[model samples]
Target: MDEQQLSAAQLAEAGLDDWRQILGRLKARFRTGDPATGFALANAIGQAAAAANHYPDLTLTGADVVVTVSSPDGPGITRRDADLAGEISRLAARLGATPDAGGLTQLELGLDTAAGTRLGPYYAALLGGEVTDGEPVDRSGQVPTVWWQDPSEDNDGPALPAQPFEQRWHFDVWVGHDEGERRLSAVLNAGGRLVSDAAAPAYWVVEDADGNRSCICTPTGR
Candidate 1:
């Protein structure tokens, strides 16, 4: 029914094995191939996990690694997930991951008169990223956060964006507390229409001008 509603086994049957593996861990997916980056990401993962005293479900997919969090098993904000995201954001900054306009998942990637707008900031917030030049950003867990957008990027950078998307960059976003209300108000204040009947009062479905759907939730056991 929901992301956490599924049994680990059912999640796997749905080809969502990664989520199941992470179990209580919120997942983070990344793509890269430089040996240096791979090692860096692995190290970051370990450092964060060990530092947080929480382990994550990490899967290596070709040139990428998918990390799912297993903490904060509650409904909305899990302490572990939040802490881990902060750690990842820090790692991204240290590595110099700048926000880009390349390919991203249909979910995270959206067109907003702002180039690298929603994603860079939204993710930076979602992941607890640091500020850079007034914009928030983080590398994709690959070390030495370089654009690595075009093929001409540094050998130790990302391959621009992973093409041929079957399972592209994907992550779970949790709207917590007053921040959700503030965002909803801003969206509405900016003329963003609420998608009623999508889930009714309990869970609201709102879309941006481009028709991308983001939910407004009350994380109170639902």
Candidate 2:
């Protein structure tokens, strides 16, 4: 049987307070305070996942462990993911680890192009990923997803005239709602200028001194 996909509201109602939906996956970080504790937490999560027949990707560091849960059958969150996330949270608490939801972030690449159907396959081949709905998704989750956007289409920001030899690629940094302002401030302080904020609380477009653009995005108002 296919797994039932869960929406952001459903996840919140399910009591997965520690996890946040990033892109299409549920991500959370646990501060273990030390390498030993972090390893212990990772191991515990592994065992629990095995027992439950659902696994999550774990990144262990000297002071923390980042966990990402995604349904293997598809790209969205499901009940299995929520159950595994709850179990992981319980394990973290038992191991004296603290959940850091504010620190969770996801990065994605966007290319402005009117020919999404044509460019999607090229990007997918270049990134060794697969094309889905005019976006290239990295199956390994190591590389950021590359999405094609049509400049002529009505989007969040004002549409610009398609020009040749202009920069059309940008980065989308997805952060938690509470972390949006702080991150945007950091970018601005680093000499980045605001390009647009019409999508405030949803996203803010900013460009560096060299005109390289990126977006500070939040789940709010999305």
Candidate 3:
């Protein structure tokens, strides 16, 4: 059966019961209390992934094992991710691991241009990332994935007004929506200004003193 992608509302509801939704992935940190126990929990997760044929990004620290699952080829969480997350949570429970909801942040790179096809190759080479069918992605997952955006068409009338030119590149810093205010406060304290909050609960554009821009983003739905 083809796995259906969950809407933001569904994803939020499903993940809140256990995992936390951040950007395109579902993340949950399991406190193992020790490295040995953490490794064991990692092994169990690996086995579960093997059985499901779905793997998550795993980071094992001193006493915490962070697990992040997402669709391999899509924009956001899919049914496979949600199902695998449940299984991992079950495994963590059996191993006496406690969930820590606030251990990680996901980042994505956005490049605005109408000539993405021409520009993407240069960025791919610069970042040492791969360009798959004209889309640049960090296959190693070490850095944030880059997505190119073109101006949207104005469908309100026959005349399509051109979008004003802006900075070409910005980082999408994904945090839980509830954590956005706290992070935004930190940014402002560091001399950043909020450029726009018109899209709250999804993203807020902020700029530094020099006019460089980035966004604080959450999943689209509250």
- What's the TM for model 2? 0.84
Count of steric clashes across candidates, in order: 11, 0, 0
TM-score list, all predictions: 0.34, 0.84, 0.79
- Clashing pairs in model 2, backbone N/Cα/C closer than 3 A: none
Q: Write the per-residue lDDT of candidate 3 for residues 1-222, one digit (tens) a residue.
A: 236778877766664455877766788888899998899999999999999899898989999998889877865778788889988888888989998775457888887777888987888888888798787777777777788767563422123223344677888888865677777889999999888777676777788887778888876544
- Deviation (Å) of 160 in candidate 3: 20
- Across 149-222, the per-residue lDDT of candidate 1 in tens digits comes to 22232444112323243322222223332234555677789977666534333345565565555555433233
Per-candidate alpha-carbon RMSD to the true structure? 18.0, 3.0, 4.4
Sort by TM-score, best first. 2, 3, 1
> What are the per-residue Cα lDDT tens digits for candidate 2 across 1-222?
227987667867999889887767889999999999999998999999899888889889999999999886667888888888899999999999999997788888888888888877888888898998767878787788787778788775654433344788889999876788888888989889888787887888888887777889887786
Deviation (Å) of 199 in candidate 3? 1.3
Q: lDDT (0-100) at residue 106 of candidate 3?
A: 80
How does each model score on lDDT?
Answer: 0.45, 0.84, 0.78
Better of 1 and 2 by lDDT: 2
TM-score, predicted candidate 3 vs. hidden true structure: 0.79
- Model 3, position 26, has a per-residue lDDT of 83
